[model samples]
Target chain A: MNALNRKKEETFKPLGSKSLLSRMAKYRFLYLILAPALILVLVFCYLPMFGLVIAFQDYDIIGGITASEFVGFDNFVKIFTMPKFTKAIINTVKYSSVQLFLGLPFPIMLALLFNELRMIRFKRIVQTISYLPYFLSWISVVGMFSAFFALDGTYNTFMATIVGESYEAKNILTDAENFLGILFWTNIWKNIGWNSIIFLAAITGIDPTLYEAAMVDGCNRFKQVLYITIPCLLPTIAIIFIMNTASLVTLNFEQVFGFQNIYIQEETEVINTLVYRQGILNAEYSLSTAFGMFQGAVSFALVCITNFIVKRVSGVGIW
Target chain B: MKKSFGEKLFDVFLIVFMVLMCVIMIYPYLNQLAISLNDGTDTMLGGITVFPRKWTWSNYDTIFSNESLIRSTVVTVITVICSTILTLIVCVGAAYAIKKKDLPFRNAIIWILLLPSYISAGVIPTFILFRYLHLMNNILVYILPSAFTFYNVIIIRTFLSSLPVALEEAAYIEGANEMQILYKVILPLCKPVLATVALWTMVASWNDWTTTLYYVNEPSLFKLQYIIQQIIKQSEVVQKMVNDSALTGGSTSVRARPTSESVKAAAIIFSTLPIICTYPFLQKYFVKGVAIGAVKD
Candidate 1:
């Protein structure tokens, strides 16, 4: 006979003689502390989740969730058949990989560099300069970029003189050719410093004893990094990589929407952005909902696959 | 002791690379600053370089002259204040509750609170929910919908777990109630980590445009981020129209003269200056705080 091992069952069983109500009374204030926040979380976060049911139905604004016609596979079918949808799905995968691939390594490198520093002030300055952009919204960063890169922008001006005067910034995002790289690089530029933070933490968590031991063994700084630092960071690197893989299908929609234009729409489009444009902008409720649900499904699959792999390999996973 | 050639070379390389990157990073901002100071022929500021061809303070003057900008700044400040307070209150409460070893329904509530981050219910459903709750376009709409995030809850919980139980017990024995302990003993000692969380919450709430974009269309309620976004979108629309008109030889020409691009840029720099200005104050903790949340596994 198998029974579920749940917390509620465990809690009551251990202190069986005590009345459940009285036991609750004993810790009443903790419950009181939690009550307002718990209610808010329930009402705002958990409740909105119940509305995911619309994914299974043909949602109508006027008709609402109840009156909406129920058609499951049809919505999913439209999503798969749509060209833009496929592009979005592919773009999301490619962009996330680009982000994780190019974006993931620098932090570990920085952490190693930072940990090597004997001079604290110089290290602080480097860290400060590096993470400056992480605080700015995507909007601000993009504004800064477009100002210098537009048709008459400095970047194009520099290129125009060198390349016989044909360069332009305005067409970069709209050219269908150069847009994806622009989006990818812009994202990297914004996040590189912020991403380095975790690696620094992992490095700092390492025991100084290891370094002292390595130093006593006459291992040079480079050798110490290769042997001691990199190996210590492996677990963290593995975890971040797995999490990145899990979210590979969910690109940052808000950032993409802010930066992308119509020409790049086919190339730079992502599943999240597609959901917004199709469902919210175009008012194709069922189709967008289906695409969103499909995205969720893919991300879930990715997360599970990552969890399995990480669990097997490193004995660590998000779950 | 004299430094070796290798060490000297490495240091030189590091400084050059760092300074070069800093220049690349600040170049765009310097360009924006130049545009803000330029007027007349530079009014368009279109594709202007790292320096203004025509320089004046009129652009900055115009921005300061906007009553709406001033009002929105005040509103943004108030929201940042309130949202940071409310978020810290809820986050500290929930994190403390979750940290209780014997608390009833702890794990269940923790999972329930966090489950929202991973799952996507789609935006329409969320929009409809907000609509139903009578929160659509309300000023509270911006603060309430995202008052507590699961990601934040997890981080604060992690920090709280590292707190010693003996301290809380000592406070309890001294006749300080749970609230008193949270405020006096736990909170005051939590200052460093609290400062980190406070900085993040403020920056995030200040930079947020998604909530405002979806839930609101009112100019009066537009946060700086949303205002900058709308202005950019308008400029993009105009840019697109101008191109279309030029292609078809349509009789219409834009009198706005591509100034929207520069204006959008100006608006962004202005909106962000406050948060960006605080970055130096909190920069010390960025590495530490992110280091914690970055490795959830």
Candidate 2:
């Protein structure tokens, strides 16, 4: 296959300068097809990347980047000294750790349990309903939850019946004690089904003959899963784990923003919201941009570390 | 594959647990549906669980009659359609060009495109750039920024690259120009992938309100999700009002406002119903699409 491909490549190579110009002309048509996409990426993505330099400057709206005074590390100093920055970083790490360590295992367990079901039709139905929340907007999810958890909401009504009339109804949304629970559980609820798909696909790729062999060896359902299924799933798990680790500094902005309120702001504020508040709402562009840069640098470092770890462990890396 | 008594019992337990899981998943939406159909005043008393006690369409009527809601619904539909087309054009074009083995700087272009997925310019600089582009409060803000989705481009490129190259070579031998080959031969074979990408784009565009939250302030440009968010916020205010009055033991003087719970529920239903209704049909393709897109790469 390698030789054939190389031979085909050789046939297409233009040798002389005249033929090279013609070859370039032919490729230019392909370039034209990609121009609009290229230009859009350049304008929106790459240009804004260069705009990160404003992190070092005292950015002013009227003067813009050109006239803004460069304040070597002053913006970073301001972010470090800000009261909310510490809380924001702590909350970001707290929620993401719970999401990664506590929340990541649920989907894998779900897929494994799902694979054990003998009823095929029932499995499909369960999957269909379970994935419904994945498609709903965060705003819709927050709306539904807010309504359900209201003071006189359905949740309170149900709780009264279960735990009796003596059960006091504290509004779940505003209760600082319940904020981490809400974030963790809601993140699991919203994502478990979607994340289960990868594991389920991996399960399907496992050879049936191995399962049969395990069964013949007196391996029970639990033993078969332990011996055959989990081993088969490790490569996929490694890839996803590394990718997720690379993104630790980032949280879903919409999810955090959707459920945010003044009462729960103490517990729920994250780094992204801090940036949003400082940059857009407070108009402190330089300080917030510095925070943004810090986030990027940390995430990039994490990606490199995780990539190295994954490569050592599995001989496969994302890059 | 015979099961022992213990295994059979375990299967029964699993089925029951799965059923409960499904119930828990759907219960919120079901509760919201009941409230949306119930009378606004009646809902304040609570205990409206799975079905409405005093059924009414007043909530739906209020939503349908609201000028901003109607306008935003129009905006959402237009935005989804326009952005889906733009995304397909950009993604397909870029993917097609990158599929060529001889394209210059192909790896560099691919790396540059994937940079956004890793590092970001955050809200401030991107917001500033959009403002400078005059996309602020403009409808184009919804359409233009989403055109170059790097993941979708990679998905399509992978799909295109995996196809048999002989078909395109045959087309070239038949005197087909590159454009003709792309449109007539290659694209026709790419229907499944294109449809999947289109569906994903549609769902994303329909659900997006963040663009409006950051870039738009004009009422004319508010999308349906943002309007639903506003309604939910209003309901929160009313809930606070009730809570405050209850704390003061003035429950007799205060009553549920007409737009408090039921109207908000109705707005939630309005925003979610279309996606839910269309989901089952798309479900068959969605699983495979995501699996192929994520797992292959």
Candidate 3:
């Protein structure tokens, strides 16, 4: 692949030296093909970026971005001092840290378990079932979970029966203590199969000859996996870990919103939801945009820092 | 190789574990289906686990009869089809253009396109932009913003770059222009990847309620998922009322009406049905597409 890229680069060097006008004329068709997407990106993506200037302004719907009064850093200062914003920041960190620590390993273990299954047909069927949840929208997943875990729902009824009628039914969805646990478990259930695909692909890429050699050396299946499979999976694992770590602040808005209720809003609120509430619902556009900008900056920093550290430590980074 | 006692025990454990995992994954949908099919009033009495106790189609009938739900369904269908077709055209065209390695300023253009995936301009700015563009409360809100994602562009570009350049060259030599080669030769070969992306866009547009929540204020413009979300919220309130009434020995008038819980379940199932029905046949292509996407070049 590197050689192919290098060869293409060599061939394109002369084209690169051509005059700008000549090159433009020569590749007019390609440029024309690219125009629609370029224009859309400019209007939607880049234009909104220019609208980020409203974060520094006291933005109102009437005056809009251009006419809004520039407040300099007042919005940022207000968000920093707000209690709700602080609570949201704390909750975001707590939930995502839990997710990062617990959520990262399950997929790797699932991939290993999947690889160990000798019956190809059973493995395929199980995989199909596992991947089913990933396709469902967060609305459906949260709705289904809410029904199952409602006070008069299936889970509570089954629990009551099992405990011989003394057990009290709990609405786990609404309970603050149990909300994070529900999020963690449901996230795992939805993503484990889909997430394991890369690791499984990596395992498949491992040389069969190494396994054959391990067998000749009388290594057990467990030992072979521990020594060979895990080692072979390190680079892919490192890359995924870095990516996950970088996005630690950005929780899935739809999932959190679907499960959110007045009873547990304090515990469930995150930056994304906070932005929606303040900006859209409360109409505090400048403050919300500042909050969002802060979140984006922190996430960007995390990505760079993690990528740098991983590159230094293991010579594997997203770059 | 003959299995030892421990290995055989391990096999049994693995099989049982896999079966249990499958059950856990599948049980929620089946439970919802049961609740949706059951008589709404009876469903509130609980213990309708895997099968409906008092079977009835009233829940679905109610959903189909509701004017707003029917409207939302139509809106969602139109949005999905329009968005998917638009995304395919724009992304495929950009991917084809980017596939030309010698295209001037290729690296700069690619970076410009890909930057948005990493850093968004946040919702408020985007909302303001939409207001300025006159896209607020418009159906085009769903179709326009999603037309260009660099991830899809890269995926299609990767697929295109992998194909033998010989076919395109042959077509070019036969007096076919670039657009003709792309339409005639390239598109025919890209069906699998295109299907994968189209399915992705379809599911995304269909499931998106946030666009409605954030952008459109007109109730007439509500999409299916947003309607379901509203139903879920309303049902929660009603459930609370039912619980409160039972505690206070109040009138069972709330109970007389078909329970909103059942209706909520039915609405959810109705909205999810299209994806569920089509996924089995298309799952392989998606799996392969995701694998290609994960290992970025």
| Candidate achieving the largest lDDT | 3
Instruction: Report how far off residue B184 is in candidate 3 (Å).
Output: 1.3
Error of 3 at A113 (Å): 0.9
Ranking by lDDT: 3, 2, 1
Point out where model 1 deviates above 4 Å. Answer: A1-17, A164-171, A212-218, B1-4, B43-53, B236-258, B291-297
DockQ of each: 0.49, 0.66, 0.72
Give the C-alpha miss distance for residue A108 in model 2, angstroms: 0.6
User: What's the chain B TM-score of candidate 1?
Assistant: 0.83
The list of candidate 2 runs beyond 4 A from truth reads: A1-21, B236-257
- Interface RMSD after interface superposition, each candidate: 2.4, 1.2, 1.0
Compute the lDDT of residue B37 as modeled in candidate 3: 85
Residue B260 shift from truth in candidate 2, angstroms:
1.2
Given candidate 3, what's the lDDT at residue A187? 96
TM-score of chain A of each: 0.87, 0.92, 0.93
The TM-scores, one per candidate, come to 0.88, 0.93, 0.93
Greater TM-score among 1 and 3 belongs to: 3
Count residue pairs with overlapping backbones in model 2: 0
